[model samples]
Each structure stands twice: as structure tokens, then as C-alpha cells.
Target chain A: MKVIETINLSKIFEGVVPVHAVNQVNLSIEDNEFTAIVGPSGSGKTTLLNMIGGLDRPTSGTIKVNQIALNELSENELINFRLKHIGFVFQSYNLIPVLSAKENAEFVMLLQNIPAKDRIARVEALLKEVGLEDKMNNRPSQLSGGQQQRVAVARALASKPDFVLADEPTANLDSKSAENLLDIMHRLNKEEGITFVFSTHDQRVIDRARRVITLEDGKIISDVIQHEN
Target chain B: MIFKVAWRNIWRHKVRSTVVFIAIALGLWAGLFTSAFTHGMMNQKIDSVIKMEMSHFQIHKPGFREELQVKLLMNDGENIVQAIQEEKEVIGVSGRIVTMAMLGSANKNGSVRLNGINPDDESIVTGINEKLVEGEYFRGVERNPILISRKIAEKYKVKIKSKVVLTMQDMEGNIVAGAFKVVGLFDTQNGMYDELNVFVRRDDMARLLGVGNSLHEIAVLLGRHDMAESMADKYQHVYPKLEVLPWMDLSTGMRMMIEMMDTYTFIIVGIILVALLFSIVNTMLMAVLERVKEIGMLMSIGMSKTRVFMMIVVETICLTFLGAPLGILLSYGSISYFGTHGINLGDAAYADMGFSNVIYPSLEYMDYLVVSMMVIIMAVLAAIYPAIKALRLKPVEAIRKI
Candidate 1:
């Protein structure tokens, strides 16, 4: 089942000399699959992920996420769709530095207007699942890089989003911390059937992803599916 | 949760938040202090006028104020006084006779208005006992005593108990003369009042002017000075033919001057507030720039633009609401203490502003409340530009931001 599909998608920054960031590309992401898009700097991997996640508009193509034409939706409707269906994690572990681990995890549910009682339970359950229940009240600054990423993953899954989009999630982490965070994400994907498409350059993250796509200079060069060991 | 986030965000950059809080507090304190100072100065001036010239309320014949002569006397002063006395707010009422007269010494000379009042009644209206500089207020009207202003006494070389001659028109329209011993001296603290007013027993003038059956004007004091307007309204209704003037309307020129001062104050304060607003806006815009990635993360996590906008505004509102009122409270304390002790500007300094001696920076409670509201409003409005910038931010670019 295709959870995300892009047909001839491209992104160009209009200037005196128009710069093409993402060249025409077609891709499909399977439901509950862990996919990694890896490329060197300036390869347009982030832009392609952004288009698929409804965060950016493709210059000339259709992006169908769960069979819905995202480009056709109004701005407000797109916001609603993102809120209800998509989750996001960032390279910086963008866990709202102001909030504690628990609060950051519950942010999406709060945006969903979920009742406080249910929101609390879901937040606690996700925090426990991420093995950060002891750090529930600790802010991102207080948590280790690995713990913060775990919190970000818990936050992404809080509202039961159909899929999660992570942009270089382990780019700012140490080797050990990156391995710990990737292990948590892999366990979550297997146990909860949550689809994830991440953009990264780290070989460790690529090794953990079930499918890997390689890109160079804004164009995809290879797509390979690794059999589960 | 948004409020919680906003509250926590303020503490994240403790030094910056503290500086913003202090800036807002200082702005509020300055605004409230100035507002309170204006209120106090205006009130002190008004009270000085009430104590020196008009009491809380004054009544006259229909055309008496215009003519200000013996001919404009109210024939039924006793009856009107009786009717006005029925109101509980009326503290004291006095019937008076006033005439423009020439006052002179052996060498120097000046013109003044001679006001004749029932001595016992006049004391209640003007606090004559408190204002006496020398000699004493007359006990009864039959003795025909007069109180000369201190400035007039010094200029004319008139001593207490010295006889002075006053020349004025009689009720029959002929120039008349009357002699009276100076029984008391007073300083009303207003240069105009001290130079141009003479007080005497009412019967003396009534006999000299030959208007024994009438009175020039009626002055009434009320329980509270602020109740003057409502009491004047009642007086106007009761005696439609007469002019019922409150102390404020009686001194229209001075009130207008004070009001003009208020307008000038508003203009200056308005400029400062605008500058302060821009400062706050610039600060919040900087926060937006620094937190671009954070905002993008919030939006990507399904926070709507409206919610982001609200969160920013709510944070501003909370900061201002907390800080501004504290500043106002500080202002209130400073003004209240100084208002009573009165930092003296000295006679020469006071005279520069055309005031008599001292300036009291007084403030009413309402003034503080108004300034608090205004500062808060400025702060909330200041948040708009930054909030709109945050709201319209595209999540993709914001997340990609450095």
C-alpha cells in the first residue's frame, strides 16, 4: 500500500538564474515502511521530503499522500491535514525547548484539540514506550541528545499520525546516541506499524532503514530494498 | 498548553525576558507617574480656587453674573436659600453683595472687587479662618468690618484696624462712599485674587448700596468638592432664572489652561509610548528570527497559524500585564507620598508656571488604572507585527532556516 507518492515532482527557486533544487522525480513510499533518502549536500533530498510531507509545494507535479492530492488543498485544509495525518521530527531534535519531555510529546494531541484527560494518558504511554518516563518532566536542554530524540519520536507518534517525516534526525548526535535513537525508531516502526520516511546522509541511519534511496545533484540514482535480517 | 509553553519560553532566555520586563515596567511607571502627577496638580489648583474664590456651588440672579452690579440682586435670596437648604448635600449657604470699587492709599492705587458677605456664613463657605494671615474675621455683620488682601495691605500701607474708604455705585445708580476698619488680612495664594478682592460684612454694603431687600449672589458648599456638578445641576433645576455654577465653571480660563496642559502631556506621552511599542515589536521580531526553526517545528506538529499567533500574543500580554501593573503600583506609591509632603518648587520657581508657592504632584486612583490599561494596550498591539510574521511563515523555509 502506497502511503506517499510523488509523480514528476520538482522545486525551482525563481531568480535571475532560476535554481532547480529538486529535479523531476517519481517515488512511492509503502505503508508502515522505514525508508531513508540519502544524498550529499545540495542533492535536494530535504526539498523532496518537504514536498511529500505537504510542507512545500512542488513546481510542476502531483504529490499524492494516501491517495489525496495535497497540492489541491487550501492552505487551511493543508494545515488540518498535516495536523491530523502527518508528524515531523527534525535534525535539531526540535522538541520545543520550552516544554518538558512529556509536554513536547503531548503537543500534537493538544493541537488536535484532544481532551486533557485522554491527552495526558497518551502522553504518559508514549513517554513510557520511548523509555523516557523518568525524564518526563525534564526539558530538552536537560535531556541527553539521545533522550531528546526519543522524546521527538514519542511526540511524532502522539496523535497516531499516518506517517512521520524526519529530516536528518541524527545529524547532530554522537555515534552512540545516534545508534540508540535509531534503535528506538526501528522498534517503534516494527511494533506500532508507523510509516516513516527520513532524509539523511549518515550511513548508520541508512543501514537501519528498511529501504534506501540514493540521490546526487537533485536526481535519484538508486532505490534498494534491504531484506530484514 | 500553549500558555504553558509561552510561560516556559519566557524563562528560557532569562536575561532577555528580565530586560523586557524591566523595560515594560519602566514605561508603565513613567506613564502612570506622569498621569498621577497631572491629576494631582490639577486637583490642587482646583481646590485652591474653591478655597479662595467659589465654594462647591454658587447661585445668582439670571443676569447677575453678566452685570455683576447691585442692580442684579436676587430679591428672594432667603426663599431660594431655604429651598436649597432642603438638599442634604448643601453644607452651607451664604448670601453676598459684590461691587467693583476703587481702593487707594495716600500714594499708590489699584482697583478691586469688594465682596460683602454675612461674616458668620462666609467663614463656612471659604474657610476664612484658615486663610487669615493677620487680624481676625468679623464676628457679626452689624460691626461692618472688612478683610483686606495681604498684597493690597502691603502696597497701600494699610495696617490692621486702619480705616479705609471704598468708592462704588449705589443701588440707586449713584456713586457712593463707605468707610470701614480693616479687621483682618488674608493671602488666597493666587496673585490675581490677592490683588483684586476685598471682603466685608454683607449689611455694610447692602446699606451703602441701598439694596437692603436683595442680595448679589448665593454661595453654597457641599459635602464633597466632586459632588459640585450634581449639586449644581439640582440648583440649576431649582432656580432656572439664576446661573448655578460649580467651582470648575466659575474658573473656566484656569480649567481650560489645565486641560490644555493635559493635552500637551498626552501628546508627549503618546510619542514615548509609540517609541516603546516599536522597541517591544523589534524585540519580538528578533525572537521570531531566532526561533524560526522552533516555530516551523510547532507548525509541522499541527499547530495552526492562528494558534502560533495567539501563543505569541498571549506571551506578550502575560509579560505586560504582570510588569505594567507593578510599575503603576510603584508610581502610585511615589506619587501618593510626594503628593502630600509636596516637593516645593519655591515661590520664584512656582511663579514661572504662574502658580503661587508649591506644587503638589497628586494623582487620582483612576489615573493609574487608565495608564495601566494604555500601557497594556500598547504592549498587546506591539505584538501584532511579530505575530503576523510568525503566522505567515512557511513551515518548509522556517525549518530549513539557519
Candidate 2:
């Protein structure tokens, strides 16, 4: 089943010289795929990801997640849809600095108005899955770079979304932390059958993905599969 | 959960938030303190007017106040004083034979109101007996004893036991002369009243003027000063032949002065609250601006605009509330202490203006609640700009900001 589909998506930044941040891109992700979108600087990989994640409106296109068109939703309805369906992991690990790890993980579910008992149970399980069970009570400021990223991952998955869109998840982590993070995400992907998509320039992320889509400028140049990974 | 987030967010920058807290605290303190001080000063003047000059209210025959004619006396004035003293709200009452007389001393002479009163009865209405600086209250003299103010004594070059002659008109329109000895020197602290009046035994003045038991003025003091106007109106209805006036009406510009001072007090408080409102707005705006990326991230992850806007408002209100209670407590503590102990002006300047030098600051419990409600309203008003700023943020553009 296709979880996310974007048809002819384009984002234009208008000025004296117009910049097409993402131009005429058509993309689809299956329900349980581990995919990576890789490109160099100014390649529109993050822009494409933002449009697909419902974080930005397309200059011209339609985005369907779970068969509902994003363009049809109002601004407020889009926020509610994002709350229910999209799990976002930013490059900077944007966990609320004031909340403890468990609180941050359960925040989206709380926004969804999930009952306290179910929210706690699912948040705890997700934290443990991301190897953060011991650090559940710690704030983001108290956690290291890799540890914060793992908590972000737990937060994203805690909502039980169809897929997680991560933008440079390991960009700020050291090599060893990055490897540890990738290992955890790979395990979660394979074991729980959760779909994951990432936009990155990191070679390590590209090597580990089941499929890789490479972009040049604002257009995709290649979509290749590495089944062994 | 939103409240929890907002409360935690306030502490993220402890020094910034603490600065806001202290501003609210000190600003409210100053505002309330100044208001209480103004109230105290004005109330002191009111007490002086009621106690020393007018005695809450006064009564005279219809034409006597406008023209100090001896023939315009209240024939039933003594009966009226006794009747007023029987009222439940009446604390004291006194009747006097009031006439303008040429008071002549060996050294000088001046025109003054010769207030002829029964010394014992007058003492009940006005506490003049307690205000004597030298000599006694109508004592140390045998015949026709008189009480004079310090200003009168100084101007006449007279002292206690000095003989002065009063020349005044009788009810028969005859100019009569009588000799009186000063027995006491008193200072009412109201320079105008002090300079214009002298007191003598009512029997002495009436005897010399050839009148019996007839009086020109009846003064009545009430238990509560606020009831003066209504009681005066009631008495005016009951005694239609006489004119009754409250203390406010008896003094020139008294009503305007009270209203002006009240307006000035509110202006002082209003200025302080406006200043506090700006301080909160600026600080909360800074807080919102500093957290753009975080706010954008929260919205991107599905926090509604309403929720985000409310978060800023809640944070601002929480910050304001933190200081409001402290400010109120400080105000209550200081006002409570000073209300009894009094704040001395350290000079007789206030007294010369007919106000007490030592002022006891006070506020009703309701004023605090009203001021608190004002602060809460100010906090919410102060929150609007920053909260709206947060709501206007676009997640895409905002998340890109550092």
C-alpha cells in the first residue's frame, strides 16, 4: 500500500530571479519501506521532504497521505492531519528543551488527546525501543547529541504514524553516535515494519537504506534499490 | 499540559523572567502605596474639617449665615442642640451665640467672630479643650473668661489672663461693650479658622447683649462622617425653618479639592499600570522571538495556532501572577503597618494647609481586589501583541530561523 504520494510537486521562491526549490517531482513510498533521498547542496532534497511531510505548501502539486489529498485540507485541518499522520524528526533534534524525555516522546499523542494510561504505556515502550529507557526522565538539555536524536525518534514513533520523515537525523552526531543511531533506526524499521524516509548527504545513511533516490538540482537523477541492506 | 509547558518555559530564562517579576512587584507596590498615601492625606483633612471647623454639620436660622445679624438667632437653638444630641448617630452637639465683634486689646484691635459657647458643652463637639498650648480650658479666671487662638494672642499682643474688650451689636441693634479676660490659648492647626475666631462663655455674651438662651449656630457631630450629607438633608426636612449644611458645603472648594485629589490618585495608579503593561509586552515579545524555531517546530508537529498563542499568554499571565501576589502582600504589609503607626511629614506644612502632619495610610480590602483585577487585565492586554506574534509564524519560514 502506498502511504505517501506526491504528483508533479514544485516549490518556487519568487524574487528578481525566481528559484525553483523543488521542481516537478513525482514520488511514492510504500507502507514499510526504508528509503533515503540523497543530494548535494541546493539539490532540493529537504524541500521535497518538507512538501511530502506536509510542513510546507507546494507552489503547485497534490500530496496524498493515506489517500487524503493535502491540498484539500484547510490550514487548521492540515495541522490536525499532521498531528494524526506525520511524525517529524528534524536535523537539529528539536525536542522541547523544557520537557523530560518521556514527556517529549508522549507530546504528540497528548496533542491527539490520547488517554494518560495509553500514552504512558506507548511512550515507555517506544523509549525502550530507541534504547532510552534509562534516560526517560532526563530533559533534552541533559542528554548528549546522539541520545537526543534517539529521543526524537522515539517521539516520532510514539504517535504510531504510518511513516517517519527525518531530515539529516545524524547530521549533528559524532561518527560512533551516528552509527549507533542508524543501527537503532534500522532495527526499528526491520522489526516493527515502520516506514522511514530521510534526506541526507551522509554516505553512511545512503549505504544502509533499502533504496536510494539521488537528486541533482531540483530533479531526481536516479532511484536505485539495494535489497541486501 | 499547555500550562505545564508554559510554566516550564518561563523558567527557561530565569534572569529574564525574574526581571519581569520584580518590575510587576515594585510597580504595583509604588502604585498602591502612593494611592494609600493620597487617601490618608485627604482623609486627615476631612477629619480636621469635621472635628475642628464644622463638626460634620451645622445649623443656623435661614438668613444668619449670610449676614451675621444678632437678630437672626435661632430662638429654639438650645432645644435644637438637645434634640440633635438625642439622635442615635449624633455623637455630640453644641449651641453658640455667634456674632462678629471688634476685639480690642491694649496693643491692637481686629475684627473677629466672638463665638459665645458654654465651655463644657462646646468641649463635647470640638476637642478645643485638648488643644490648649498654655493656660486652662476656661479656667484660672473668675469673671467673663474667654478662649483665644495662639494667632489671635500673637496679633493682639495678649496672653493668658490678659483683659480684652469686645464691642458687638445686641438683638436690639445696640452697640454694647464688655470686658473679658483670656483664660486659655488654643491652636486648632487650621490657620484660617484660628485667625478668625475667639471663644467666650455663652452666658457672658448673652448677658451683655441683653438676650436669653437664644443662639446663632448649632453644631452637631455624627459617628460616621460619610453620613453627614444625608443626615443634614434629613434634618433640613425636619427643621424647615432652619438651614443645615454638611461640612463639605460649609468649606469653600472642599468638594472640588476632594474630587481633584481622587482623580490625581487614579492618574498616578493608571500611569504605573500602563508602564507595567509595556514592560510585560516587551519582555514577552522577546521571549516569543527567541523561541521562534521551537515554536515553529511545535506547530509543525501539530500544536494548533490557538494552542501556541495561548501558550504565550499563559506564560505572560503566569509571570505576572508571580509578582502580583508578592506586590499585594508587600502593599498589605506596609499599608497595615503605616495605617496605625502613621507616616510623619516632618513639618507643620500640612497642618498649615488644614491637614494633619502625621498621616495614617489606609485602603479598604476592596481596593486591593480592584487593583489586582487591574493587574490581571493588564497582563492579558500586555500578552496580546506577543501572543499574536506567535500565532502569525509560518512553520516553514520559522523553522529555518536560527
lDDT tens digits, residues A107-188, model 2? 9999999999999999999999889999999999999999999999999888888899999999999999999999998998
Task: Please report, in order, the local distance difference test score of every candidate based on alpha carbons.
Answer: 0.82, 0.91
Position B217, candidate 1: lDDT: 81
On residues B227-286, what C-alpha lDDT tens digit does candidate 1 reach at each position? 999889877987888889888887768779788879976876787688778877887888
**Residue B127 lDDT, candidate 2, scale 0-100:** 84
Kindly give the stretch of ten consecutive residues in candidate 1 chain B with the minimal lDDT sum: B347-356
- Give the DockQ (2 decimals) of all models: 0.76, 0.83
Cand. 1 Cα-lDDT? 0.82
| Reference contacts preserved by each model | 0.82, 0.80
In order, the first chain's TM-score in every candidate is 0.96, 0.98
Kindly report which residue stretches of model 1 are placed more than 4 angstroms away from their true locations once superposed.
A115-121, A128-131, B56-89, B139-144, B169-179, B206-214, B222-249, B254-275, B335-345, B348-369
Model 2 agreement with the true structure over B190-220: per-residue lDDT tens digits: 7777888899999999998877999889999
The pairs that clash in candidate 2 are none
